[model samples]
Target: MKIVLIGGSTSSMTVAARLRRLHADWEIIVYQKESYVSFGACGLPYYLGKHFDDYQRMLVRSIEDFAKANIQIKPSTKVTKIDPNKKTIYFETSDGQQNTDTYDQLFIGVGAEPVMPKIPGIEAPNVFPFTRLEDAFGLKKLLPKVKKVSIIGSGFIGLETVEALGNLGYEISLIEAQPRLMARVFDQEMTELIDEELSLKNIRVFNNDSLVEIVTDDQGQAIKLKLASGQEVETDAVIMAIGIRPATHFLKNTDLEMINNGALVVDRRGSTNLKDIWSCGDCATSLNRVTGKNDYLALATVARKFAKVVANNMSGLKTQYAGQLQTAIIKVFDLECARTGLSEAEAKAYGYDFKSLIIKDKDRTDYVKHQKPLTLKVIMDKKSQTLIGAQIVGYNSAILRIDALIPLIWSRTKVDNELEQLDLPYAPPFSRPVDIINIALSKLAASLEEG
Candidate 1:
């Protein structure tokens, strides 16, 4: 058997690794647009922060490593087109050359591209988008001369980049078109906490301020960012981190069902509408178990899980993607934030009769030194008392706890049942009189009774 995986991402590498393990005799080939494979793209920010050196360290597997497994790694090769009927792909190699390769089965994991707006002076040298190793290199080359860096979005990439560069003596200004920072995934109360943390780091943030245009200054080098609020500021450079759309342009000619931002539509087994061709990861559609609707959740954690399902099904094994809880976590300075399942706005939009409670609890008992306040909230259906979503923002709460709530939302666990049966460790140093999460949720359950 011969398998070809296109556009190397974490998911693609995972599928390749698993396939090689299961069928060692089979021919496995991976085509990547860049020399890097299995790159932890999320680490790009930290790389710039001087937290680590050595670009090769960012790669999970080298070309030599894959070769040892008999998986042919073709670096700097771009798959331009896919012919599902013919089971062939037209590709371009490093020398600007084109070739054709046939495969018995194919998997596409092209990942995504940073969203860029149609603004003037975008082609200028100073403006960039942080989505690849190339962006990291660009930022490094420009870092020494960076006295001030203006970021255009306040989302994950933007915030990470801001904090990464701020420590390097660069005057950072983060501008957000939304009224609140990280407002899309975070609530206003949580956003305020993030804003306060950023302030402590001496990073300036502008909210509800839209970038109108980018124009070159009189010197013809630096770009001036103009805002819709009739404001303008000169910036040494700009990194656009507004959002990302799936990098599925190559599959446009294919008859695949794509609706949510052109993410490839696939059923439980990762098989697309077309036969024999499969897709997963950031490039494919992600189903939200709570919404019962398809969405695009571009995260490394989900991609890894999806890859396993695709690998098994490709080998004639039955598997399913029960969908995701959209769990996410972020760090800004010393603060940690996490969320699982849906948000209040999402529940209301889904037409669920829901009620939510936001509560504050001490991280530890009064006698505990360095006790800090933590916020926890959960949204649930009033009638069923089922947990639909949960969020937490605090110090040392171990944001991984958010995953513990995923089953509650995905399985529609009753709030009372989970509260009583959930196995939880009791420790004074780690938590208050009652676990912070439990204390807040228990109060939420009580609120339902009064109504």
Candidate 2:
């Protein structure tokens, strides 16, 4: 069997490795546009913050390693088009040589590209987009000369960049077009905690405002930023962390089905609309376990799982993806936040009759040396009394509790007296006898009963 994979994203590499292990004699080839393969772009922010010196640490596997496994990797090769009907793919080599390859099965895991806003002076030399390895290297090289740094967007990447730069003692300002940080992911009450954390760290936040123009000097370097609210922020550098869209423009002319954002719509088996063609990773949509809808989940966790499912199904194992909760966690300064399943906004949008509550409690016993306040919010479907969503924000590993809630949401476990009595491990230094999860569950149970 001949299998061809596009892009070097985590999903593609995972499928390649798994397929090689499953069938040693099968021909496997990966065509990647970038020079490096299996690069973890998530670590770019931490790398820029001096968390690690060697950039090679970001690579999951080297080209030589894949070569040893009898898997061919064509680096700096751009896949221009895919003719599903002919079962052929057209591509350009590193030296600009056009070529074609026939494959029995093809996987498109091209991933996504950073969305660069069409604002004036966006092309300034001092402006960078935090998406790829080169962006991190460029910004890290210029960090010593940069003092005041402005970041546009407050999504995961943007806030993480703020934390990375703020840790280096750089004066940082965050700009978000939304009313609150991570507005799409968290509720207003949850975002208030993030707002407090940013203020405590002395980071300036410009909410409900967006960058209108990047004021640059004559040398084409960013000097300041003009906002839509007539606010001007003086900065030496700008990092555009605005989200990303699937990099599937090359497939626009193809007959494959895609979402509004260009992400290929795939089923639980990771099969695309066309036969023998599959897609996963940031380039495809996956099933939302809670909502039962195909959602564009660009999370690495989803990509890793989807890759395994796709490879297994292709290998005749008939595996199906178990769906995802969009589970995510992040830390900024002293604050750590984690969430899984649906948010209140998502639950409402999905037309679920859900009841939500937030409980503020202590993480540990009063005798503990460092007991911090923990806040947990849970959304429960009123009819079924099952947890549909959960969010946690606090210090001292409070976010870790989100893991316990994941199974509850994934299994659609009812939030009743039995769940309220869940046997979560507890000690004075770790947590109270009644963990915050239990407290939230207890409240949710009461709400369900009252209705």
Candidate 3:
């Protein structure tokens, strides 16, 4: 059996490694557009912030390693098209040479690319996109000489870039078109807390506004930003971290099933509409456990797990992906936030009869040093009495509590006296006798009983 994998993304590489181990005699090859394979793009912001001086650390596996494992990696090769009927793929190499290969099975994991808005003067030399490793290296080299940096968007990458640049003493101005940051993922209540944290860090925020144009100098350097609200802000450089779209343009003309945004649509077996073609990762949509719909969750956690399911199914294991809750966590300065399952707005949007509650408490005992204030929000389905969503915000390790709620939510565990009395460990240095989760669960159970 011959397998050809596209993109050298997390999903492609994971599937390649797993397939090699499962079938040692099978032929596996990976074609990557970039010069390196297994690059962890998630660490790009930390790389720009000088968290580590070695850029090579972002590479998960060296070419030599894959070669030793009997898996062939063709770097700097861009796949142009796939002929499902012929079972062939055409690609262009770095030297402008075209080639074709035949495969019994094909896996597409091209992942996503950063969205570049169509604005005037967007081609300025100082403007950069924050998705690729080259973007990190380019900005890291340029930012030392630049003082003020303007970031467009307030999503995960946008806020993370703000924290990274702010730590390096660069004045950061965050602009979001929505009324609040992370408007899509987090509710307004959670965003308000995030807003407070950004303010305390001295980061300037512009909400309910968007970039109209980049006012650049004669040298093609951005000097100021023209906003939709008739506001102009000066800046030495601009970083566009708005969001990403699936890199599936090359496969548009094919018969493969895709969502409106070009994300490949696959089933529990990670099999696409076309036979012998499988896809997973940011380039594909995964089943949302709570919503029971295919959702584009472009997180590495989803990509890696879904890859395993795809690989096993291809290896005759009949494995299926269990779906995901879109669990995520982020840190901004002294604040840490984590969330899993649906938000309150999401539950409402899905037409779920849910009750929600928020509680504020301390992370540890009063006698414990460095105790910080912790806040928790939980949403439960009234009909089933099951936990549907949870959010946590606080300093130190408070966000880790979300880990406990993830399994419960995944299993749709009902909120009852047994769950309220969950025997979570407690120590003065870590948590109180009754953790914040217990407190929140107890309150939720009481509310359900009263109703």
Instruction: List where candidate 3 sits over 4 angstroms from the true fold.
Output: none
Worst 10 residues of 2 by lDDT: 442-451
* Better candidate number, 1 or 3, judged by lDDT: 3
lDDT of each: 0.84, 0.92, 0.93
Model 2 lDDT per residue over 81-128, tens place: 999999999999889999999999999999999999998899998899
User: TM-score per candidate, in order?
Assistant: 0.95, 0.98, 0.98
Candidate scoring better on TM-score of 1 and 3 = 3
Which candidate wins on lDDT? 3
Q: State model 1's lDDT.
A: 0.84
| Candidate 1 wrongly placed segments (more than 4 Å) | 218-220, 398-400, 417-423
**Considering only N, C-alpha and C atoms within 3 Å, which residue pairs clash in candidate 3?**
none
